[model samples]
Target: MSKVQKPEKSDKIDNIVGMLMEYEKMTVDLMRKATDTPILEQYDLNAPYAKARIIKEDGQIKYRIDEVTLTDEEKKKLKEIGELLIEELDVDIKRLGSNENAAAYIRKLVERIIKNYKIKLTTDSLDRLMYYVIRDFVHFDKIDPLMRDPWIEDISCNGFGIPIYIWHRKHESIPTNVIFQTAEELDKFTLKLAYMTGRAISIAQPVLDATLPDGSRVQMTYEKEVTRRGSTFTIRKFRERPLTCTDLIIYNTLSAEIAAWYWYVIEKQASVLVVGGTASGKTTTINTLAMFIKPNAKIVSIEDTSEIQLPHENWLSSVVRTGFGVSGSISEITLFDLLKNAMRQRPEYIIVGEVRGSEAYTLMQAIATGHGGLATLHADSAEAAIHRLESEPMNIPRPLIPTIDAIGVQTRVQVGEKSVRRMVNVAEVVGLDPTTKDVLTNDVFKWNPKNDTYVFYGRSYVLENIMKRHGYKHEEVMEELNNRRMVLEWMVRNNIRDFKDVVEVIRTYYVNPQQLLERVKREKMEAPSGGSRPA
Candidate 1:
């Protein structure tokens, strides 16, 4: 603690020490003179001091501290003091980051600055310091504007030197205006992310898929060998508020009539196959539509990534694991594997996230073998959706296609500068021709792009069978359907956005249509434009 007797040779140490203190923006030379002492043999080059802009804006370097020439005196003192500080805090850093490597390191950096100087890390840190000094620096903090952006559904980066891009719910995909200046910088940033997620991104593990603590999905490609351009990362963002059917209707993804009609299809125990091209919003539509199920019904949702968020109390959501515990663990369970497990769970409805391969056969067999099922697939149309399921790996039987009660196809379309997606087609799988092995389908509703709205009430052939099974006269069903439509319009007018209310109204109508219609007319009046009544 007393002046650690600085020898004449310590002058060189004091000079470097002054440079370290200056870089870190500290002013005291008394704390920096230990480097000039013969003890220099004990420590290597003073820990690289990530200091402020060495050369000021006006091109003046503060080479001297308090009128002391930087010759040998100030140099050794500054280097000695700075090394002790960095090395000591480096210990504090190791402790803080024992569990959270990168985050804890960042935290320790911030804490040390706050503890040593009166500087708050939010405004000061080596990370930010180096960001300005280092070439190709892009500030992508977790709390950046991109994370707060409501429209951004995903964030992706191929590597540094290229712009980062994001998929907006409204705009689809657009450049984020954030770019890394160099590949190395991008690689380091991605490494920080990997360490933060407690995953390794290296030559041994070239790929990483993990969720950020905030629930944002992140995928990374390790350096040079794994990805031609050093490193890469992508973030598939989750939404702030899960879109409900009404939200979809308000967004014009579907109309009230279409939503109400689908409610009928889903409520009546019909197997539904939602199909769309990649990123066309199929799973989302299925998630939204699933709100129609009876809350008491047992639903099992299976997926590789747990994306489907069903709010029903009786739902049991399951996700498949590549393997468990440790390395050498067999990659056993898959969507198909879960399907077999789902059957034994006594689920009234099996909701597969998507039928990419043979899982389609299980979904189809479930539908045909007296169990109602709901699933999504990557296909553009009803026929294509079926073909994808029936051909090759899936090889679902043509006859079983009819067992699929309906097909819902969603697609992305241009709506001005922004892109909007909607359920473009809904088809009812009516039957199969035994002689020709051909499947018959009826288009229930479709989006009429000319009108920019989905056409509903296109005579659901499946609804006819439902009516027959219920032993209701055809005339009664037509009246009931029309009456339910009026009630829905009234509910929409009355600001009844709750699907639960819709279920209630539908349930009442099912019990006694005439009474509910009379009661609604006597209570909730309808407006001419057919929108939900304003509160």
Candidate 2:
């Protein structure tokens, strides 16, 4: 029997390159198999170079040639090529726009370098070289594919040697295959992310909290001394377009009745406070509720980080700043400072994204002074929220609490195997109990956990307050509520849930309520039977 000879590395490379050289000419399934895995489908075929693909895997995860696992020697070569590209290529990165354009530019520069150096390689080797070059210089390296996956809501790495986990929109938290096994590799990647945020991280300032290039919130620990587990980072991905009232309606977060109640309350310039636990979608609920604000109202929003997005033309968004440099040359601007300054702006509506400290006191005072205020707080229930406010750090006077006309309690409930966020209660602040000195709230709407339905309790002091404030008759207020509910249903029926579309309809309603009502009625009458209605 003749002994079989194992193919050498050079021979394998030559064979792969020769095969690729004729790949374009052949007419077959364009599927390229490497090892045992295969590239199932290309995301962007028109791009100048290779794009990512949905690997032929069970979990529907993605893979890219640039992000594939490499051996130690291959990594060393990739590093050498990356260094050479940085030294020889003087391409202006600022001129680049999208990731595709940047990748194309880098590929062209690399091709020139290869020719100038008289480098001879197969097509497959050339592709491998380009992958590392683009990954290090043009893209976000290993995490690029994760960022491209639209279903991911968050990316979290506890420390080196641990697999990265992602919070997917549908599947919830899931452990990914990607990981950094060494502290040096993890530290370098963390610093790269920090620099991308336009910030610095070091032993002196061993913490970083900043927004990434794509507006994702990045919070990191720099060294092992601070974290005790090497470097760590968490990225809360940003939604390109925020959720709207119509979206909440479709998601069953809130009923059209609750949304319409908020609309009428906001139109009357009443204050509202949203309370929820961490990751309970408090900010999202409030952001959707802000859509109820009159389009022409002058609005000022203050936050530690910029999150709220409104379609109003007369809006000013302000973000707090942290001190910088050795001596802290740049003064740190606190949320309290922003709130106090926002009051002087004479805004018709004031929005505090999240109140954590004395800023809550300031927000409450603003509401008491009759500034149509809206804010979110970390609490589980309405009473818990009030207790937090009246407690230390956020010591709002008990009497002044009623200035917040309504409190919306958002909760994350476990339904079957999944967790979902729901607006459990929309309570109207009735008054302070004279005997007990506690807040008296009338629950206008409450979530029934048994049936997973939002039930109307009809306890609406908010309507009475609106009547007193707007001087509209009871029947007129009821009619307005019914009409607005119909409009919301009409929007859901027509799938008009885009932020801009929802804003346009609401603004048009403000301009001509009768016309808008007539149009909505006509559409509702023409809809298929068994559609959703106000709860």
Candidate 3:
């Protein structure tokens, strides 16, 4: 009835314009809410900023990380906002509990700045801005993505203007597009790394060897003091979940039989040493084998940088500390000191991250004293490991060297256009020859490169000793080994590679072998035929 009188055309137009303006405002508000959420919480924003792919260049396989391009205007805006945020922000990133929390806090701060300045930014632009801000503030900066990449094992920057090199798990070492364009930029980044590790680096203290919060090992040199080319840094990314025996088997690093053998000897309290060249996975092997120790055993691990991750509840991890003041004035704790201290702790097992300097002698002594010792050494073969033990710095006597019950030699080799790690040889330290005073080793497992298969030598002195110690007959020991091999194989087939899950299976076996074995057999029979064996 009231609409009998028609409204003016100008009024109708004004009403339509107001509705359009309100709709636009509502859309903008919704977009702001979505963008303001922590990038870590957003599935789309959480995707890896960069991806790596294998490309053929010059008839050779190459690893390439896709580069992200930003417009000049975007970069200019990013720099301005980054400087302002750094100047105004007062939060200590380390105390933020986790990367997620840090990201959320930084996002809130960024939103505050945006609102205060009334800066107009699209949702996509805001996402990019938040990612970079969180990355620079919470992670390793330019190398953060490299660190986040699970395939990258190592990252090395020689100096400024040099491309960073990354050791891809698949491609081995390859150069990356990321580089520090100037000496000052590299120096600043190196200092930031040192700061992240809670260590100081300067002209006075030019060297920094420390463990990052995420357990990665970082070594840095400051300001051309120790390094000739400005500043340099190397990061050895640590595996958050240590490799399990099942994982090694799946990777073909070793045969299931070798893993079973390790399980048997390690359970019998036999000492072991993993030997390999740099980046050949010595520490990884040690970590995997160390999982075989009894769950309740008292274990003490000493290291310069904490790299070993064990599931044992009774484990004590000790790291060497560099003292303040002068080198001689303030006594610095060394591996030898920690080893001696660990000896006093009455631990059943002593794990040395690596045997170097006088610590090797102490480790051998601990092994000779009947303390189960597990360590890693820089050597390519069992014989070389023995030689290094007998040489200076180690100086482990010939008789004491036999206390090391097993030596696992790991090597990186090229196989059909790919680089892989393999346990080339696993030898048991039988004894020292009385006449020649030479260490006698019995090869238990050898890797055959022809077909990339591992050959069981059919004899293991360590297993024999384990059988004797446990009062098991030859047939019984053989059966036990076979059962363990089957269990490991089943795990590989079933994809039970998580460290905790693997350990649970192992502990279950230790508690009730028959139960676990029966379950494994049932599952193996039910599994698909194609998945019965590891690739």
Compare the candidates by lDDT and give the number of the best one. Answer: 3
Q: Which sections of candidate 2 miss by over 4 Å?
A: 1-77, 88-105, 121-128, 325-330, 531-535
Deviation (Å) of 146 in candidate 2: 1.1
As a TM-score, model 3 comes out at 0.87
Candidate with more favorable, higher lDDT: 2 or 3: 3
Model 2, range 213-234, lDDT digits (tens) per residue?
6778888998686898899999
Ranking by TM-score: 3, 2, 1
Query: Ranking by lDDT, best first?
Result: 3, 2, 1
TM-score of each: 0.70, 0.84, 0.87
lDDT of all the models against the reference? 0.67, 0.81, 0.85
User: Lowest summed-lDDT stretch of 10 residues in model 3?
Assistant: 37-46
Which of candidates 1 and 2 is the stronger one according to lDDT? 2
> What is model 2's C-alpha RMSD?
7.5
